[model samples]
Target: MEYEAATRHFAALGHPGRLSVVRLLLRHAPRGVRPTEIAGTLGMKSNTLSHHLAELEGAGLIGSAREGRSLFYTVRLPELAALIAYLGQDCGRGRPDLMPTHPTEIDMDRPFNVLFICSGNSARSIFAEAILRSLGGTRFRAFSAGTRPNSVLNPFAIEVLERNGLDTSGLRSKHVAEFEGPEAPRMDFVFTVCDQAASDECAPWPGQPLTAHWGMPDPAKAEGTDAEKGLAFAKAFGELHRRISAFTQLPFDQLERLALQQHLDRLGEA
Candidate 1:
């Protein structure tokens, strides 16, 4: 992701104040600028400057290192250099034939991969994955697996999905181990539907994904007549669909990690 993603950098720099602040930081260079000094020089309120700094930091164009009790902010020159090299790589050292006449483009809609984990890949977690896929297919790739899968989806879960016009053709249960290795896709978010005690059963994934616990009563564990079990799956499906709908509306790229994590936690509670 060049420049914390070129689109993000451009977005963060689009504001006049942020642009000016970046230029100021650039002047300070390798030594860095203290937060107080930046606010004083820019004549910006501390809260306003903090907002700009968070945006810049999230875009990867800037970094901070602690100095005493204060944090010093500075441009990430190496990242900037890498972005320059990436843009120039296509120029073929001034080869007219290879160089693009127009500016480079970035696909800002790149999907963020999400994984849902549960004790059994049967009901709640599976429902979450399917709900997110159907609701946020434009911006998310959703997956689900269990610590110890039973090798079959709960028949009721499939029925609920199909009833809502969601595909269920290849919705077989899988072990979480399948996605723990190097070959697995890099996940941006990991939602654990199992409680804390049972969560330990699934091995930690390779990528340090942003994770949260969105536990719900496991619908598959309902011991009742067919109608009662169906009702349970339906409730889980409705709840997951509501959460996914709300999640997809978030300004995902604009949010810093901590803010994004907080939103995810709150979404589960709602």
Candidate 2:
């Protein structure tokens, strides 16, 4: 199957809240569930739950219908089947012994490593690193770097992130050189988050990591009053959170190498 649709499906399932929502709905399939019931059971805010529901519907993972003034949602079994099949279609193509027959065979303990790069690691790249760690720390170890490293991280970025419940402790602006050698942690994925870095000369990462461009404005350079600048930081943080949240939900063990790379590239698109 084409990878774009699978990316959307994976992105939809990435959020912890949405993943829970889908599983709960799956248990009550056919009969379906109302928003109130879902929110009550999950102990989630109504508005927040609504947003998750919308995402699930958008990805074709769930469906909704109006039942006399109340809305009900159910799993889209066919679409779910399609996603599973796509992930396994190329599995063990020439190596039968390597195929995963059970979920336990998936090597999740070998956490994936990721690196985010930009001209200055004070804003977009730093935010991407933090958000991914916060959301997917169990499966990923994320790092950020700058070609032109700053003496310290952008204070405004830290302030805004802390206000939104993220810990800003120990995060510092780092030079890309720190991760360049054979002894350094090899990255499984590398993302360039600014136009300057995407086009500028840079040292190659050691592993030939899957790469993508997710260019965003340098919120650290936002020209405005503090409040306005904070708004810019928040906006950039939100976008990174969404993308990283989606990234963590992919079925890594199930997908073929080429298929997984396609999804990663599609996810970089705004």
Q: Encode model 2's per-residue lDDT on 1-270: one tens digit a residue.
A: 468998999999999999988877754443457888788777899999999999999889999998799888978977987777776665335354544342233344688899999888888888988898799866899899987855468888888788879878778899888888778898888888875566455666665676777777788778879999899999999988888888899998898666776687677664
Best-performing candidate as measured by lDDT: 2
- Estimate, for each residue in 1-270, the C-alpha lDDT of model 1 and write its tens digit: 444476677788789989877877654444466788788767899999999999999888899999788888988877766555555663246466554342132124678889988878888778888888878867889999887745578899999999999977667788888788888897778887755213244455555566766767788888789999999899989988888788889887687676776688788667
> Looking at model 1, which ten-residue stretch has the lowest summed lDDT?
99-108
- Measured against the true structure, the TM-scores of the candidates, in listed sequence, are 0.58, 0.59
Each model's total of backbone clashes: 0, 0
lDDT of 2: 0.79
User: Once model 1 is optimally superposed onto the true structure by TM-score, how far is the C-alpha of residue 79 displaced, in angstroms?
Assistant: 33
